[model samples]
Target: MTVRLRPTLAALPAYVPGKSVPGSIKLASNENSYGPLPHVLERIAAAAENVNRYPDTNSSELMDALAAKFGIGSDRLVVGCGSVSLCQQLVFATADEGDEVVFGWRSFEAYPIISAIAGATAVKVPLDGQTHDLRAMAAAVTDRTRLVFVCNPNNPTGTAVSGAALLRFLDEVPSDVLVVLDEAYHEFVTDPSVVDGTTLLERYPNVIVLRTFSKAYGLAGLRIGYGIAADPAITMAVRQTQVPFAVTQIAQVAALASLEPAAERQLAERVAEVTAERGRVTAELRNAGYQVPDSEANFVWLTNGPAEAGGIDATAFAAGCAERGLIVRAFADSGVRVTISNPAENDKFVSAAHELRA
Candidate 1:
């Protein structure tokens, strides 16, 4: 007889990661094309000597480092394998069967999957102008809504909601329902008007802001991220659901090293470079006649999908880039998300786009 698996998983979609083609300039994963900072690499190398031993289950050193960097109490935080892992933990800690988890439809792909795995219903609100429709999301909440994820500077689309709009949405959401502001791309954001989730923590005890070392810190391979919550109870709940030793020794040391003053300054300089490249790429794409959204993150969005007006087939575009030795993330018929890298890499992708148009 076949072993019985949870029937709900039948319709659940598997997370599709960005493809990697050797020798190609990859902009598919929204990764910092610049790898780990020098000091972080040193820490990782030093920690490699102790791989035989288990990682610290509590990730105490990393936690303390993050606490000091953010100027918050350690009790307000919980480290996870990545912000994506924390996404799952948030669902596990708050939602159960018959409950609902709310988020934007195309925000983070993990939102729906995590909800399904936890046996919670997914409530997805459509974007307003390629950004989170905060009002619609707040309206989607019901008495059974246990968790809400707001992926600021949203994935794929790379559009962010304004601070005022977000605050309004937060005001409308029920205080008991958890609102997780997934800011995995926080370091890449340059917009002054965008909502910095951490700033709202004191005002909304229900809100938790998620940040990651993966992107700007150049530690994507290390998979270290954290959540900041005003309520100690929420932090406790998330920690309780975490897998023991999920953050490895190497990852912890790398993250701690990244918090060093010199390392942080270097990271900031890199972020500035990415931001400048983002503007250049966005302008170039728009001049080339693609409906590119205003991105506050490390990537730019091309809203060319079968359903979008004057939309180009995103898969075709991605294939074209692949042929030109550049890789970008394509969402079937939805659109393409391209990471903003060094000037030369960005120019290469732009040239590919022009070639595709030709």
Candidate 2:
């Protein structure tokens, strides 16, 4: 036995993050156009003086603050470098060799790859009409399935399942099979039917809500995020599995300050702006000969399909847009996924769409 590793880890592809160009407007990664608060920057600057010291190994202060804010106990929550890291940890905790992880195809790109890395089989259910079909996803479950990830306002597609449908699906899934509701974009949703992960967690014991400060909080550079779970076992495993002092001191301070009532109020206004822009920009794209979907997240989904659900491919179209200086994500043969940034940049995207379509 020379060097045999886990087959799943050996076979999985590394995650490809959106590339950053020097002068190009990056709409590829779903980052907030608005920078972090001036106060957060100040806190970071102050913390930089203590670079020689290790971070709080337990992140006691940050966890306590999050628990109080979310109305969950400390035992129910765990923080990570980012929500993506929390995702990898969740798979490690719940899934074992030969276990299954179910999710919608073309949803979050990381779900399948991370599932494989955790020694679990990834069961990718195809999306129905660019949305997560709750019934179909729920039905895909087998006894071997250990975890199910529901990306609310599912990434790339930006379509979400209705609250009623989600409630029903939760009831149908096995209580033992952990259902991780990835609500990374929950801050930008404007629709009434969409489920709020914080509120939903009160009703579902097995549910683990994953959130990030990278998006609406405008702390992408800090890479701070957390998981909200009801059980102590999961949280304990996560706290132990994580490397010592992972979340930096500055991140803890910034995140805690951002959770203040005043900051939340400000965040609400920013969310309103994004929601409005998403509607406006999506309509403009549709008017410009693009087949856009009814996106409820802080992004829009466009298809160069329908006329040829087999005709002009979306990846090719995305590549064309990249050539024009606007970076958009193309999901293979499926449509393109554009993450909505700020109002000014959205206008630029709309202008680019008109130029390309015209």
Candidate 3:
């Protein structure tokens, strides 16, 4: 007899990471170009000495650090291998067959995948323009909805919804349903109107905030991220779903070192640089006649091409950039997301964009 697998796996699409071409400037993945500070590197190297021992599955020291940093009880936190892993854990913890998970259509690609893995239906609400239509999302929520993910500064688009609209949406959602604020790009957000997800935890007991060391903290390879759960029950559920000792000791040490005051100050300056480059890139794309969205994160979103180019779609634009030794992430029939790197790298992208437009 042939071996059988879960039938749902057939419909699930494999996640495609950004392409890497030798000698090309890759602006496809939304990663920090900077590396960890010298002190943090030293800690990570030192921690590597204890690799023979399994990591603290509870991650006690790291948990305490995060709890104190956010002024939250240790019981309300869960650290995962990465925020992406936590996303899956949240779905597994809450959803089951016949239940539903809701998120914006183009927000995070993994939302639907994770929901499907949990044997739950994925209910995607389309975006209004480049941003999430909160009213539409609120309307789409049914009694069967178990979790809702709001990816502020959405991926592949770089658009963020305002705080007021988010608050209204939260109020509309049923208190029993969990609303996840995926703030992987939190450090790069410069908008005052964009609500910090952590600030909403106390008032909204159903809220969970996911942040990462991958972006501004410059530890993408280390893969340490955390979730702030307003409810201890939710925290417990997410923690229970974690892979045993998935987080390594090196990752824990590097993350803790990154949280130190000196390291954080330096990282903040680096983030400021990225945001400034983001502004420059957005303006340059606009000047080249590309339809660019206002981005609060460390990247810019390019929609339809200039009218002069017969309104080319993202794929075509991405191909043009690739030919010019630049790699950017493109969504089929949607748009392109270009990461903001250092000034020189941003200039190369701008130059390529201008050439493509012309």
Candidate 4:
């Protein structure tokens, strides 16, 4: 007889990752088009020699580096496999069965999935325009709310909420609830008014700021990210839930190497290039008559669905781009998200979009 799994587990929606088609320019995932820096690669290579030994379970050196960089005490930080893993850990740490985890509907696909896995109820507030509706999210919180995720420069949409709006939302949230500011794409953010989650930690004891080495640091394959909290107890709870040896030795060393001045300068240059390309691509798409949102991240959003383009859905648009050796993320009937890469790659995607319109 088949073993019975929990009904919730059986029904959980699988996380859909961006497609990687061989020989195609993949603008589906918002990864830094540029790969890891030379120094980071060198450190990773050095770390490889010690593979026989298990990784430092605590990722002590990496944690120390992060603590120094953020000017926070080591006790207040928890490094994990990735920001996504920390998202799960947060849910497990605070939410129990029947408790609620609130977030924006299309913010991050992982929020709802992680909440469901933890047996917590998922409460998704709809976006205002293409950005987060912080007020609506604040209103959604009830006594049963244990956690909330606010994806700044939200994934797939690439729209960010103003710093003032976020502060207002924080003021309204209850002190007991844990609010996570998921800033996976923080490095790519160019907006001056966007809330830097780290800046608010001192003021909000319940706030947790999540950052990743995946995007701008170009270490997506290494799977290392961290969460910062003013409360050491909250960090402890997240640490307790993490899988042992989750952060690899190579990932730890590479992350440390990335903090070096030269490597940081190089990464900053790459970010500048991506940000410039983002503006160019957005302008081009707008000129092409698509309703593209103002993107602060390394991607652009096309919110007009099938009806906007004489009944051409996001899936069809994606498929057309695929035929032309370009891959972009499409959300069922909702919209399309295309990553801004180097100029040549962005040109290919732009050409694909123009062809699809024809």
* All candidates: TM-score: 0.97, 0.94, 0.98, 0.98
Residues 1-358 of candidate 3 have per-residue lDDT tens digits of 9799999999986787788899999999887888888899899889989999999999899999999999989999999998999999999999999899999978778898888889999999999988999999999999999999999989868889999999999999999999999999989889999999889888999999999999899898999999997899999999888889999889999999999988889998999899988988888887878888899888888876556743557898899999999999988767888889989989999999889877
Better of 2 and 4 by TM-score: 4
- After TM-score superposition, what is the CA distance of residue 122 in candidate 4 from its true location, in Å? 0.3
Name every residue pair that clashes in candidate 2: 308-311
Error of 3 at 178 (Å): 0.5
Candidate 4 local lDDT, 171-200, one digit each (tens): 999999999999999988888998788999
User: What TM value does model 1 have?
Assistant: 0.97
Cα lDDT of all candidates, in order?
0.90, 0.83, 0.90, 0.90
Global CA lDDT computed for model 3: 0.90
Error of 1 at 12 (Å): 1.6
Cα lDDT tens digits, model 1, 1-358, are 9999999889998998988888999898988888898777877899999999999988998888888888999999999999999999999999999999999978788889999999999998998879989989988999999999999989979898889999999999999999999998888888889968999999999999999999988889989999999998999999999998899999989988888899889989999999999999988877777788899889988876543353578888888999999989988757889999899999999999877766
Tell me the lDDT of candidate 1: 0.90
Off by over 4 Å in 2: 1-6, 306-312
